[model samples]
Target: MEISWLEQVNADVPLDDEWLSSGEQLILAGMKVPKRRADWRLGRWTAKRAVTAHLELSSHPKQLSAIEIRPAATGAPEVFLDHQSADISISLSHRDGTAVCAIVPSHGVVGCDLELVEPRSDAFISDYFTTEEQTLIAQSSQEQRDHLATILWSGKESALKALRTGLRVDTRTVSASISDGLDYAIQDEDRADASVIGVSRGWYPLHVRYEERQAFEGWWQCIGKLARTAVSVPAGGPPIRLSGCPRL
Candidate 1:
């Protein structure tokens, strides 16, 4: 698997239209919001770069713009080379000028989510988390509460993405169990009671990973951090490991 990251997208930076395929050009041209356009462009840029790095493609094999990503019927991103589907599974998430792409072999699926480390409201937690997860969070020390809560929430999102439903599923349907050092076990909706959760079903034994990126606090200061989490299918097999953080 390969992970790519890009921080602080600049709206003014000129994007080379030649780097985008014909289908991508239409998607880009149809956008009306400036910020939305920048995010869409940045995500494609990061995903293409990731695909190139994974395939180890030299400039001769293909041009960067030749790769294209389009949505499948389920709305999961699909990679195409010269407008043909490539045998690869991918997941994407971005927020607050930050973007990330996680790619893996087509046999299995993967999902990733980025979130800022901050306090969450009681109502938000109560509505999204199960009773067991809430008890675990309450057991943590005061200082660890924020980090733990954010990570748990991010983990749920990642699991949903791996299932290709994204946030459309109820957050409470998925449960998270954090052990040590950001390692967690996810019992997807399948583990839930069918009658209570409305017959929700998904992959089981999903693995969860947590990582953070340092945030710059001042001109010469970098003190804060952003939390990120990911989940993948075929859980009992080889664990999905994260690579080094990408440079901003």
Candidate 2:
């Protein structure tokens, strides 16, 4: 089945706590740092919106407040509705005031990440990436180096999230591969129609090899200066964007 995903910017999130569950509001109040608070709110708002849309529930503030997102022992977010656990899996990523959430069936596993396309030092790359990944970055043109590096790193993060290990595990244990002849500039209209049953248009195929044994199938895309990736265990079709989300 295709995983459903959604994206929301800072402006799309409400400034008030009315949409937040009581537990969530208490958690928000405990955050002291300004940026951390803002990022947490943005992530929660995005995740709630994605969950509501995926479950075909109402998006009203009262309804949203009934949905709670709490962290598990592993620090991964878990979804609860009216204090009951929801049977779904979701992964969230936020960067530069923008957040994305990917949802899959309860029995399925998924991980997603958003990263800014920027320069990384050789030491940074060598420290985290596998030798093959470092070689891929080294062979890329100077103009594409930053973007390539960002995509590679973002894919690793996604895979790590899927594994529920986050950065706790050695990143070098996973290797990412981008498709050949990828067109980063493909427009929404220029790509395949939404009715098509395959990888979405404008998104490129990506494969992540883990521990020289387990493999993950996923997709990646470049949106402006940001790189986004989603990986799943059983593999997923193109992401189905959830409609009716708020925008500002």
Candidate of highest TM-score:
2
Clashes of each: 1, 0
Cα lDDT tens digits for candidate 1, 165-244 = 77776777676665554322122212222223221111123233222211101000011345556565533232222332
Query: Residue 69 in model 2: shift from native, Å?
Result: 0.9
Global CA lDDT computed for model 1: 0.60
In candidate 1, stretches whose alpha carbon ends up further than 4 angstroms from where it belongs are 1-14, 59-62, 182-224, 236-248
- Score each candidate by Cα lDDT: 0.60, 0.84
Candidate 1 residue 139 Cα shift, in angstroms, is 1.2
* Candidate 2 Cα lDDT to native: 0.84
